[model samples]
Target chain A: MSAVRERNSSAWLLPPRPGVDHGLRKDMRRFEDQDEVDIAIVGCGAGGSTMLQRLARAGWTAVGFDAGPFWDPERDWVSDEAGSHHLYWTEPRVIDGTDPVPLGSNNSGRGVGGSMVHFAGYTPRFHPSDFHTFTADGVGADWPIGYSDLRSFYEDIEEELPVAGEAWPWGDPHKYTYRPHPVSGNGEIFLRGAFASGITAKVGPVAIANGRFGNRPHCIYRGFCLQGCKVNAKASPLITHIPDALAHGAEVRADSMVTRIGFDERTGKATGVHYVRAGVERFQRARIVAVAGYSIETPRLLLNSANARFPEGMCNDFDQVGRYLMVQGAPQTAGRFAAEVRMYKAPPPEVSTEQFYETDPSKPYKRGFSIQTVSPLPITWAEHVMAQGHWGAELRRYMSDYPHWACLGALCEFLPLAENRVSLSEEKDRHGLPVAKFSYSQCENDQQLLKAAQSVMERILTAAGAEETMTVKRYAHLVGGARMAADEHHGVVDSSCRSFAIPNLYITDGSVLPTQGSANPALTIMALAARTAAILVKGD
Target chain B: MSLPLSPRDGGERYPGFSSVDESDHWDRATQGAVLVRLGLPPDIRFFTAREEAVARALFDQLLDQHSDPRVPVVNMVDSRLAEAETDGWRYADLPEDGQAWRETLAALDQDATERHGQGFPEVTLDQQASLLRAVQDLGYAKWHGMTAARVWSLWTRYACTAFYSHPWAWDEIGFPGPAYPRGYKNLGLDRLEPFEVRDARPAQDPAANAGGDG
Candidate 1:
């Protein structure tokens, strides 16, 4: 019997239903000249796609626009590095300071589904402690709303996307939407270390569908989770939210790069958005407008919208449009076990040990990090193997050990630092808008966090009977260029993720996150977008 | 033998499968149609003749895999640059990767020429290895504004990326490329698929890669 013939629908992408059902193909596309709606959402990635779904459901005549092309997986994609060339936001940005972040697809994705198209399904929620960073420790600002505030939104989102996970003894306010994925050999190797070190490890609550749910498919575990899943198994926004949004009488237009916020008076309120598509200039009018272009471009839009009324920028009256940036300083640890781990055969994040997720008073650092299992693709493995400053036979020996390697990445909670932020560069894009400039350096607390996280990860790896362990410190994702705070003076947006100066404008991407929690930021961004959507639906 | 100037294009493509699958399309029309171009460019897109020579020499030491025709690591890298697919970020001191390759390769050839009369590719394998060691040592002189250490790192990155992305390289590492519609079911620590190669060699001896000498 052939595996191809008997293979269930879960092994492949859900074909765009029968007739005029697929979002882009449906009778919803707007003529470029006639572009006006009640709500206009920018950058149809995670936040925009999630907000579009909720807004469409709430009966807001919403239209979403993305700068990149709408990806039709069957027509456009094959799981390869070639796909990354177009998918990643490869626009040139000046990265300054000692530890400037790795950009491109790593920070932001460029297409219809946005960064979610490339992100793994490692969807853990933020701890309650993550919300009250300032209250617990006097270093960073605390989130205006806490865990209890967004708990329902998280639960609703979990149900909608239906994440696969197991409940933990450590308090999480949500329930599993689906049964956890089966444990893999890499997971077993990681769990052995965690158990030996007396740390609690559980199946990570990933956004991957475990079984056939909605129109999406279950994870086939082909092991290209970071790359766009050819199968609709991974719960990317393209498969999960965008399709739902389009079905509900909403329109999503791609290749439309929103360059400026159209405002009679920006601080007074937003009237519409100015966008360019196919080299044709178009203006989209809306009573309500939202900017969900992730962290870099979200702030870049506000900064670029500096008009006669708002001299500096639309939301930058207090110079808070692009401040208090937070990127979780990640330090990865890899270990080689005698037994073959076959890390490549399973999903990237198989298990998560959040035992160190909270602050320990005994430790010098105020916050902590969690270690989650990870194994990179072949190209990345080869690069890292050679990075050990050896070549020839030694490098060859390491390549043979790729099947035997097990690894974990620590997501340390990062404090929002004023100096670490995005700004508009003098250099402009092809559209004449200033490129997003990134400036960041790891602070003393960040150093403290890295040192502590590295020590614990090394300890965990050592206890697992690893022949050897390697630790590498690097940057993960970017968050909080336009953070949400209660006061207008403190942040760009209010607790509702609405621009305080411009009441009609809302920002609900990673940009609105005040403090970065030690989790993959996508799920939190979606939950925040849902909460904000609820508020927008219920009025002021 | 040189590659075909233009591959024979197959007209129809079976919807879901890629060019890599022989059953899907007899001739690759589009999956990697761009990859099959009108002959190799007169000069590799990003590299100068000198740089190409250096890359050829360096990959010999970097990959050094025992294969029938050592996987064309340099050709793969040339294709990537021609497509302008590079790691988005680079050290501020380094020029844009396209220019950086030319400068660094020229520097490597110069260094080799100074030691011996010929360029990198013409040198003996042991001499090429010695030159690589010099490049790794930070104190070794650099040209065209890049440090020797940075140049060595750059070459190593491209060499490894190009080498490991190919099926020939996968064969050496015992990798079964691309589990797609058919996913792996036997995920036990030591279990493998029927086609997958199980590592028969014993584990690395403790003293072999002890991390001290480098």
Candidate 2:
């Protein structure tokens, strides 16, 4: 007992280190501007963080640059929704088109963990058909790599995140690591509705911890998942990968915004990156540069990095850098019930069903949507109430009845349209770079799918004994600006997420997805980063 | 009026639920942050005196807060604008949120002078709401060189954000505020945490009695 007692503390089951000791080390190794590392990753979010960890473990020196702060969640995050707006990338961007997607905390984040810090912790994997939508349903573009390629990475990341849920019967039919957390009142209403509607539902696969794995604690059921988890119960790269990456000798430089990828004119390969830290411009040299700035910033960086060698952009030789931008049609329906469904008491994501993920012959749409319980806080609920044309006394009245309402969101797979894209606007940011001007409009298919999804949501709510229901049209999870394809003629990157135009440059974020499925994009984005890091380690 | 769990005039739905009491059980950081909403609001720094008057009237109409013990929404909104805590993206057609707020407030006064022969704050609540409704009815049409619908979105978005972040508003909504260290264990349908109070008017359809300019 005395000899093996220390080893039996279950500490060996944890990933490299207990995640709580994320102290911003003052004496950590810092590379000079002229020192060339093995890899320089832009945006230390899901993709960059994952790649940095893998590459560091393989004995490759790596550095990551993020425009946001390296957050100590306990200090930086609060339980209040309005106080948590600092975590989002709230830089001024221009939005246009028939349906302008509202860009703020919902879809964009700025900190070391990126959007996952504020994301609702729903980490469902994309369906197998999502890899080949063109082959299966004859609609959207097929991914260069199939679901089988990212399956192992997904499994590994799931164990790393320690995802909690019941055994999933949808998509590829997998089991999560931890048993499902208890369902909240909002989730119960959703399950009740799905059962009544003859649709099967399951309790989560959210990346939030159920009990405990490492130094991270269990979820507090505080209902502030979108406002950055201060309890260390949720999974963000800041905890899941960055700590391990740091332990393995990866340097993450926070509040340093990478403005452009520096390219060698003669070699046609990436030299490094030009970034700005506290208003001072600097350069970090690297053998390889990976841009993981998600969709908008990734394409924005490529387009802004035009040189004498590639005047159009780094990977825009065939004019496909900022094309095929996509967003899931995330419309929410809130139902008022007789019972108190205090949705803002637990984690926002608790239950989901992918029954309508594939196309049905009876439905007019080619692809379908997934339904999840989305719990909006007070301010968000006010917006939902006002979206239904209620103001004045009506607004106050509806908002006062907030405790009895629960919401359901439908993530309809909007097709990747070339015209719906992110281009550089004339307006400049504080860094003097042209801001991203995102133009979006629903196509005929998108409009139809949304209509179908909204109808189904209303039906489900009505079936669940809702006295009244109101639908709000919104969008979530921006992806696919610098997409991957089989050829350079139609896409920016290749199957390995390497730029076809530049040999050592890679794009390993949601921007490289050829088509985004109805599933949340965080898991797929991380999986892609793992795949890219594996390919790089293989010397391919 | 300052008593615990007192009814808020005639519209109090959760009669005896005090959101401030729930604050005591929160973590120290959260409790400190939330309790500040009850203290003195920030001064109006972004808007002028006239702009402030017009904006306050607009918020009063928007949230239906006609009398005393207001949530200081105008000041909250002013602090946001003065601190540049905008909601990130601005519509390509519109200016930044601060500039748009100024323009819209001035436009409201201009519209009031045109329609009612008085300023927006000087006009009756009925006249002010009708003028606002006219802009809302425009939908996507132009009003004073800016899109009417977007201006409405900006005004309501800021107003709602400010109003709903207060404990007074939370009390009216029966939201047990800031559950951090002390989390709920009872999670089933209609299950209440020990600190949470059940909704008294759960069956009442708020929409049925909803009355405004429309």
Candidate 3:
């Protein structure tokens, strides 16, 4: 039998479901223009989608507003990288500071699922030390809450995402719900390299389905994880939470860009959000409003809603709304081997290790980073090659050697520097709203962690018998613009993610993260939203 | 003789692999997009005729497309600019990417004239490469009112994005093109999917051959 026929045999096939059901919007509830909803969520990505699901399940009338289209993955997403450009937020912003973070495809997303639609399926949980970074290492701020507080939510999200992996042994040790998926060639190389370097590694806890998961199909190892999974196997809130939210009477309004959060000065609370849809400005009133537009836009919205009562910006009484922005020092190193590694097979995220997650007295840096296998597609591989200053025939040569290369990425826990911030610039978007001016610069600790991380990657690759290695300097996952802290003076929101100054306003996204751990923030962000929804429900 | 736009013509590096043939198994949309990239590329909608001429020459030199059947990188970039599908952020020092592209191409011509008494497109390949190298070697210094390093960044990013997205580029690199409904079963180290091709020149480190530290 052919390989395709053998793979499609009865043993590999799941008990067939009809197909992926994306018609959840069919019976979705539509609120009247005058009706005040119980909750209004902004940006239907990881956090907002989770919030919408949880709030509606708790019998609250909620609606989510997304700036981009309501993506029917089948209709919208393509397997090609450049063709999938519509999935990213492509509105121009001014990037500055010593080391300005590149925006767009790497760090931002558009449409109903937000960046999660294009995110690699890695979903590692944050360590306990992440919450008390200041207490643990005397650097960065502490989260208002702890890991124990969100532990149950993380477990719940894991079951919902139905993560597949070996029993995790590092930090807050745990086991996954599904058995680990088969490791790919690139992943096998990472494992071998880690072993040869005397470091530990495991298969995955990626959100990509390993077995039958609801109506979602199993992963085919198609290698287009970054270009929006055409296979429903990869977990995005689009499939994981939004359909559930719709079932529970939540409405997701796509192509509706929320411009500003309307304030009620007399009540000292939020009224609703003003948004633009199809070039028409409209308002949606809600008793309580939540901003989950991730790091950049969440703070941009708050700062843009500056009224006479709070000229510095709403919830920016202490000027902490858009401060302490953080991105992981994600430098990827690719090693060329004698055999064809063909890093483009399977999912981009296959194996990872958090063995170097915490601080060591021997190391100069206070925090550490995680090493993981990263497989870049042809276009992304070309970018990786170009980042090393290769051009002309030299660039073509490296790219042609694509099949011989395997890659590893480091998620270095860079300390949040106050100077690495997002503020409104004089320039405006097509909507006439001021665009975000993001300034990012690495601190001493951040620089040290990156150097160490790159060195370790090189060491592992060299030990694994690589003929040559190329390092590409990059960053990933934006977090912390409107942070959650112990008091109003230190953060924009409280432990419950409620705005410290405005009673009815809340922020539930990666923006609420005080100190990010080395883990990918998707799972943590979803857990935080889940926690926030439960708190609101319990309080009511 | 191969046609000027033949997808099969550019797979010289990986003589055995053809991403165009591999596209037969891809889903409709993906297959359509990849095949379209191999066909007659889009017209010059964003750049002026003069700018397009300069850009075509620049992309050829930057990508080392020295012969016929070259990937239409200039056209791909022009389409991106026409649609305003920008990368979202611009350096504070430089103008928007579209405007910066126009200004820089003009500057390249001016630099060519100053050094070799010719337009950029008319200059010798060696002279063009040297001029571009001069701009790159300026690092952060100002050239034509924009940071030289940023100009290099702008040009290379667009050029690489356009070039590598083409089906011919995938063939040249031995990439098996888009795998969708048909996913891989053989996933162990050094195991190629039945349809996937192995590297023919794995022993030769291109960086070592070219003395590129990268």
Candidate 4:
């Protein structure tokens, strides 16, 4: 066998080295020659990585399979372009072709660290109303659990991740004493601007310990966290829980693409997972299976796993596996200044204002919006600005001084719409697996809310001394395709992240988000993963 | 957020550089020498030629056509020489010896002035002759230094590093300068006069005329 093939096959033999966990080494060894494992986790990203660590600590023998390679701080950033595309495990040719092509939505990673490696590190708890969004607003279905139920779990996640910034007094409060310090100048400017215009704004927490409590180093303000942190400061799945899990004896296999969830002839539960390794198809049996391959890939796997007993595909009895998609508003606005302001040299903005988070009884829409601050570099700003025809030397002259620009955008809450769905496309990959195609449209209420939020953004920027401004029309905050609820009829999973029909199967990614909150979803997803782990540990 | 000192604050001061003696003749020569070391084509003839009137006339004509004449001309000459040298032009390659380089520069300066003078009208010959005399008395080295300094100042303002390789300087200027040209009015103009607002001309209403005819 070639060196690369040998490396791929022997990946599991290398025991978890110190500080390098996430079960990658262990998984590689467990599946090196064996045909099956006791339990299999389909993804090695944020949710999957977290689950693997928990399972390993609990002495559950599990293996993880991902389509991409392990995270290497030096090689990953230098080789990969800094954008949303870096999140996925795509072919080289596809990456080359899609480098310049902008997409409408961002997806999760397919590598060792998975999407969590590229996450912006913004973490926030879902409010009480977020859990009962459907009951409160009569929009989507209610989650199986409430905010009160998940509060302690949220604290656990915060401690594990060691988030920065203080908790909001008005929002779901936490007992954790560690609060992130006040956000820097740019963040304060955004909050001030929002408050000046009657919008409630406050400092929000991010999973950036910055060397306060963890072995991870402090943020160097390199402004390239999305590309992968070179200093290992940010709490990505690879850096945090994944290593601990691997040290505790969990195995993680990189570049092993799981094709289907194989089931036994007599039993309805999954018996094993069929995966492709170095062009060889192999079946690995496990007592329990966790499909943490994200909303997109998880459903695609199930839809492809067709058989004689379950003709419609695994867990397709209700045909509600890929329904009720919710995506947040993509509305954004930017402003330019006269002096130098190096906004891109620091971590992403640490403050967020959710004054309009709840539904207004008088308004046409049932849910309000949340506005957050972000600072981008000149090149990114130029591309977005020039897309609106602000081009040529005039634009160049305006961008000559750094740090003279700032932006505020709204993540408008999206109601779960059943018509928005994910389906297998006619397009196939090199392995003959069908690609996931998404069909989505915003409701009239969603559009109105987005429009109102955009106007508010414009007014805030104008008040903050912005001479010029512009907005991005479409958003990419994809959420809620495989929602969680109390019953199988209305949702795919329950509050504990377990599928309503399958006893052992669970999903801890954005797939279980019933209602899209008006904020970044990373924090909520982390909180849910922690909550799921707690529930499983308590044997509930 | 206090704005940096205005451009008139003797331009942004650079450390380890003398700004006290603006009229010091030697300061100009040193500036011109630095530009030459940075691969720029120095005006060697400006430091050697005896006829002040002819030199002054040529300098004035160059300044009139190109707002900042020194660096632009040097850049053009260096680029042409580089191309010619690459193409194996005999005269394009400078000698290893410093003196030989100086001689070649002097010859190129003479050729440049002849080409520039060829474009002017014959009626302005007498006026040009008098200005050339004044330039000769000013001393060639002194004049060349002053011109080089002015060019460097303009280039630095736009964040260009034709004479410097400091990355910090590039970052300060926000790198790529203005995307649009300052336009015809700013080019070579000594002063920027206020523009007069003109009333809009009546719209050419072809429809109105056509209706009346119908």
Q: Residue-pair clashes per candidate, as listed? A: 0, 0, 0, 25
lDDT of 3 by residue, A126-215 (tens): 998888889878998888788899999998888787689999998889998788888887888888888999999999989986886655
lDDT tens readout by residue for model 1, A1-540 = 123212112112235331123524555645343456779999898799888888887777888989998887655554544334566887767666656776775666888889888887787788887788888888678888889998888776766665788885554645685788887777887788889998888987888778876455566776877767766777777777775566566788889999898897524778888999899888888888999999888988998999887889888889998888888988888887777777887788789877887778898888778888877776777766655666765665567557777778888887888888888877676798888778888888888888888888888888988878777667788899999887988898888898888878899899999888778888899989988888888882
- Model 1 has a DockQ score of 0.23
What does fnat come to for each candidate? 0.29, 0.68, 0.72, 0.02
Off by over 4 Å in 3: A1-22, B1-13, B211-214
For candidate 4, the lDDT comes to 0.55
- What are the runs in model 2 whose C-alpha is more than 4 Å off? A1-19, A22-24, B1-10, B212-214
Give model 4's share of reference contacts: 0.02
Any runs in candidate 1 off by more than 4 Å, and if so which? Answer: A1-24, A31-35, A81-83, A171-174, B1-43, B65-68, B110-131, B139-153, B205-214
lDDT of 2 at B34: 81
TM, chain A, every candidate: 0.94, 0.96, 0.96, 0.88
- TM-score ranking, best first: 2, 3, 1, 4
Docking quality (DockQ) of candidate 3: 0.59
| First chain of candidate 2, TM-score | 0.96
Pairs with steric clashes in candidate 1: none
Q: Regarding DockQ, does 2 or 3 come out ahead?
A: 2
